[model samples]
Target: MEFAQALFLVVAGHNDRQEHLSRARRLVLKVHLSASLSEGESVRFLPPIFGEVRLIVHQFLDRLMHDSGRPIPIFNQNAGSLDRRMDKAEFDRFADAYEDQHRENIAVTGEGPEYFAEYKIKAFREIVDRAGIEVNRICDFGSGIGNSIPYFRRYFPEAALTSSDVSERSLALGRQRYPEAGSCVLIENNRIPVEADSFDVAFSACVFHHIPHREHLTWLRELHRVTRPGGLIAIFEHNPLNPLTVHAVNTCPFDENARLIFARDLAKRLQAAGWASSRIQYNLFFPRALARLRPFENKLGWLPLGAQYVATARKV
Candidate 1:
């Protein structure tokens, strides 16, 4: 009778453990499916499912380790062939639907795409204004569809504006949208197609992440080469440390190939590319819901929790 009772308890414990694991797997799969659908990918695709399975397993192990009070091991999943890199062609394809897709992705923030674009230009203007530096020529690097043209005109009316991008289709769209903004220059072979030391400011907004990590230095060097002495090279990028920023990137179709960089890392890259007085400033701390608190955002630039960051440096 004692042996039978012990056997029954062991079987019941094993069944409970199995049930727990099954529940965990279902939860992981549900989350994975939601994310995949949001990204505009079909769950029926085998590669994505396989990737999700890997993530699910890792998450389960992480939870187990946490419960055991042990340090969790990180697993970096190589996207392999399943993840394709975006290039000029991809940008061209995205150009037509970029605005609509961006609107949809950022709907949760209760702001339009132009608001984001304008803020970066506004922030850069403030930085240079405080330093008493007058910008006469501005080069908008990776100026997709000339979204920044109106803002550039609004803030730096006297400065001559030049737009440059790798996507010809996007440039065409920009030309149509802003005929008075002049011709948009095309970048070829990672080159800016412009004279050296020609601009007072070389600005890029959320463009670097789309670029290959190995080629970041080359592009930074190009921007440095185009910027005159005492001129500013300010770049705005999505802050990966912020959960909302991560979600934004994950859902944005154009950001499929994005590899986010930390502000400190970008600052170091700027130094490596022969830039001087490099500084990092975080931005977009408060959403539209809390616009009343935005006045305090300027004082919070040192905080790393902002939705995006601007890494600024000067050529000297």
Candidate 2:
């Protein structure tokens, strides 16, 4: 059977909205007609024209539920193609939907709110303190729901705080939760509305993994641009190599499209963005069952077995 025909046959039995089914049928016909094209008779069979076939196949289930209007632009031309950046509007839609779905427990995934609020944020604070970076003005990029507010207050009560994110719902909730944040900026198109060299300390927790890998260095450069020459930028991301971290992200509805990043990879991206003194420190080595072992996690920084890692670099 032809490729598009086979794909249509596979999806034909599924129950879906009429509009969705119509779109799917049209999509199938579009590809089937493309596949049926005859060779140019150059004594050679032309390579198959699979213009948007790959996209339809990947998003078959997604099309059944909601249409993203313009399908996400697929820059990859083949299986080996690497570019995966999404347009700003698409990312904004994703962020808005994700936050709306998980607003009640945005910070309380994997384990729960108590553990995330106490252990995870506390460990990040310790990492920051140990690095001994002075904090006067701080910006929490992608600070959804302001889960880090309490910890930021505990770590540097007097520092000016700014919470920024693409989701207005998240920013509203953050502002409600942490009134002390003088600025609750809504970011668009990866452009931070704040002035350059405005913050002394810029940090993001579990934010980069949600960003497409192709734009990682560009975002890092933005972080660097907004930070003072001697300021610090700390990035906390899920450790891709850790099984529990992998499972958590894979299972989390909000993280359905997330791509976990490695500590070394994050450090390299920061370096490429003109950051200096890049360092990676692994954390969350033990589950709550072995809470006492947490104290010893400091010594295991050299090990890459942690559930998450923090990459710290100085802006130059």
Q: List ranges where model 1 is wrong by over 4 Å.
A: 1-86
Give the clashing pairs for model 1.
none
Tens digits of per-residue lDDT for model 2, 1-316: 3444534443343333455455655655554455555335431354443434344453443443345443211111221125554433434455445544544433333355445545555665665577676778888988887777887787677788888887787787778767776688888867899899999888898787767777788789888889988888878887754545554564456665566676787898899989998998887876656777778988998887687788999876
Best by TM-score: 1
1-316, model 1: which lDDT tens digit per residue? 3323322332233225445434544555565556567664564555664664446343543343244432111111121123544466669999999989988999899899989989998999998887667899989999998899999889998989999999899899999999998557999887988889989989999888877666789999999999988888999998865656766776578877676776888999999999999999999988899899999999999987798999999888
Query: Over the full model, what C-alpha lDDT does candidate 1 score relative to the true structure?
Result: 0.77
**Model 1 worst lDDT window (10 residues):** 71-80
Q: How close to the true structure is residue 37 of candidate 2, measured as C-alpha lDDT? A: 56
Best by lDDT: 1
lDDT of 2 at 165: 82
User: What residue runs in model 2 are displaced by over 4 Å at the alpha carbon?
Assistant: 1-111
Q: TM-score for all predictions?
A: 0.75, 0.67
